[model samples]
Target: MRKQQRIKKNEDFQQVFKHGTSFANRQFVVYIYPKKNQTELRLGLSVSKKLGNAVKRNEIKRYVRQAIFELQSELKANVDYVIIARAGATDLNFHETKKSLQHILRIAKCLPKVRNEVK
Candidate 1:
């Protein structure tokens, strides 16, 4: 995801959480909000302190980032997505994380509609 497309302000997270819809899988709790910019999608990742130590938190965030990066193009445009990491994420292997991410995306209709879009 591009730097410009990352949701940085705490207010943005608050707004998204208050107004957007949410979907969850074993690893991630995804909140998505529609926006005016049809060509941009903002992403916010939250790995709570309760989940683990700093190393574990960062590691889980890295895994989530990798999953989102791979599906950047397929992700719907003009949406603000906040991904909250669950405790389950810390123990998941790469393939398991990938599958969990995909599962939530599919449920949320956030995955690209075309098969080829999900790379």
Candidate 2:
């Protein structure tokens, strides 16, 4: 993700936290706040220090960033998404991290629903 596509300011984070609707699964909590007339979506990630040391935390953030990059096309524009990592997230590998993020985004209605069709 580019720097412009990230939610970097403390005020922006607080605004989203205060006004956004939240959804969660076992691994992540996602907060969504819609912005009018905006064409891009911004992402913010939070992994607590309690989860591990700096290396572990940075690894988790990397996984989350990569997952979001892959899933960007499926996500809604005109919104800010704040994702909080749960303790369970520390044990996941990259693929598992992507899956967990997908799950939470689906719950938050950020991703379009997939239809099951037998060909």
Off by over 4 Å in 2: none
* Per-residue C-alpha lDDT of model 1 across residues 1-119, encoded as one tens digit per residue: 57887889999999999999999877789999998855778889999999989998888877877888888888887899999988889899767787798889889988744466556
Task: List the candidate 1 regions with Cα displacement exceeding 4 Å.
Answer: 112-119
> Model 2, 42-117: lDDT tens per residue?
9999999999999999999999999999999988889999999999999999999999988888878888777899
Q: Which ten residues in a row have the lowest lDDT in candidate 2?
A: 105-114
**Which pairs of residues collide in model 1?**
none
**In every candidate, how many clashes are there?**
0, 0
Per-candidate Cα lDDT values, in order, are 0.86, 0.93
lDDT at residue 111 of model 2 (Cα atoms) = 87
Per-residue error (Å), model 1, residue 90: 0.9
